[model samples]
Target: MDKTTEEKFVTLLEENQNIVHKICRLYTNNRDQHNDLFQEITIQLWRAFPKFRGDSKFSTWMYRVGLNTAITLYRKSKRTVQTQDFDAVMFRISSEEYDDTVEQQLKLMYSAVKELNDIDKALVFLYLEDKNYSEISETLGITEVNARVKMNRVKKKLKKILNP
Candidate 1:
């Protein structure tokens, strides 16, 4: 990367720190895990930076790198810690209304996500974030038919988990 390219890369990353942070929160659950995941994601993004052609919006492309990194970076072989104590911490956005019941629902969603196979989790995350089938397919380099099938399966699985 030349000086100009390096400057451009820095600018892109500075602009998308929120994207990285949001994905980290969703994927990692808590502080230690969040920091580790953030570091891993930053490394992955830097590694994949060269391959980012200007074919799509930067946010979308960033999401692809992020999802891939979170899905494939490391497998935690041992379970650690326990449930989040409500009084200690929670996920909240000032721009959105925060109801305790909704927080519980969000927790349930995250729990269900944690139980998913990596590819399934990626599909689920993308679906929840309102990605269209074509966009998800493109991001994951899968065919539209495959993306559709996977999304249907994900919805059914989420329904079962949420209902049961």
Candidate 2:
């Protein structure tokens, strides 16, 4: 790519890097894994940048690429030995006045989210981001109805995991 394109890409990535970081956090369990995933997603985004057609918001497109890259890597066989807990890095709430019960519940919910399959996890992430069904479907390459159905099922599944 030309320098101009490279600059543009870098600007966009910088502007929206938190999206990539969030995906990394969701898919990875440790700092090393998170960094690795972040790099991989950035590489994937760079490679696919030429084909980006401005059909959706840049952040939305970033979510699609980032989530797909994460799910793809997550589906591969586990080879890395996990040496640290993810709670400290991924779930730390820095607010001094936070409620303990709410914090614990959030941790439990995130733990349950971690246990979900790749697709289900992606759906939950998108849903939590307040993406409409159409956006979710476009991101995951599923029909809108399918996205709605899967989201409902995921909600029920999460409820079971949380309550049971």
Candidate 3:
């Protein structure tokens, strides 16, 4: 936590904030839980910063840290679950551009994702991010074949949720 490292940390966070946000959205149900996850991911990334060797793309590094944090983080208490990260970062989106049915379908899909297991959620998140099977396998230390098969299963699970 020296000043120089702090500066680099800020730069790092600024460069890859979107990865954290995407992971949060896929894994959590609401603004509060998502923000908690966002803060936790930020902290995890900062702690693991010294280990980053630039051997891979920054987004790849982000996937490792963000997914690790999300899978491992647990609630300290129900009352303390909400976090301030969302308030700290301002992202603008226009919901009005979408019609009501589209919005409803989007919400339903998010709700379905929220019900999946941790590893399944990770698969769904990667697929939603448009990551290739090879990239996801590298990030998760699995074979590309396994990644594709799991993605298929996650897709079927989500489809069942939407239909049921």
State each candidate's clash count. Answer: 0, 0, 0
Scored against the true structure, residue 109 in model 1 reaches a CA lDDT of 79
Tell me the spans in candidate 3 whose CA falls farther than 4 Å from its real position: 1-5, 74-105
Error of 1 at 52 (Å): 2.0
Q: Sort all candidates by lDDT, best to worst.
A: 2, 3, 1
Query: How do the residues 20-107 of candidate 3 rate in per-residue lDDT, one tens digit apiece?
Result: 8777766665667766777777766766888889888778879988887777664344323444344543333222121234346567
Q: Is candidate 1 or candidate 3 better by lDDT?
A: 3
Name model 2 segments beyond 4 Å from true: 79-105
lDDT of each: 0.69, 0.78, 0.72
Cα RMSD (angstroms) for every candidate in the order listed: 7.8, 7.4, 5.6
In the range 1-164, model 2's lDDT, one tens digit per residue, is 78787778888887888778778767877667777777778777887999999999898999999998887777763624223233332222121221235435456777899988989999998898899999999989999999999999999999999899
Clash pairs of candidate 1?
Answer: none
For candidate 1, the TM-score is 0.73
Please list the residue runs of candidate 1 whose C-alpha ends up more than 4 Å from where it truly belongs after superposition. 76-105
Worst 10 residues of 1 by lDDT: 89-98
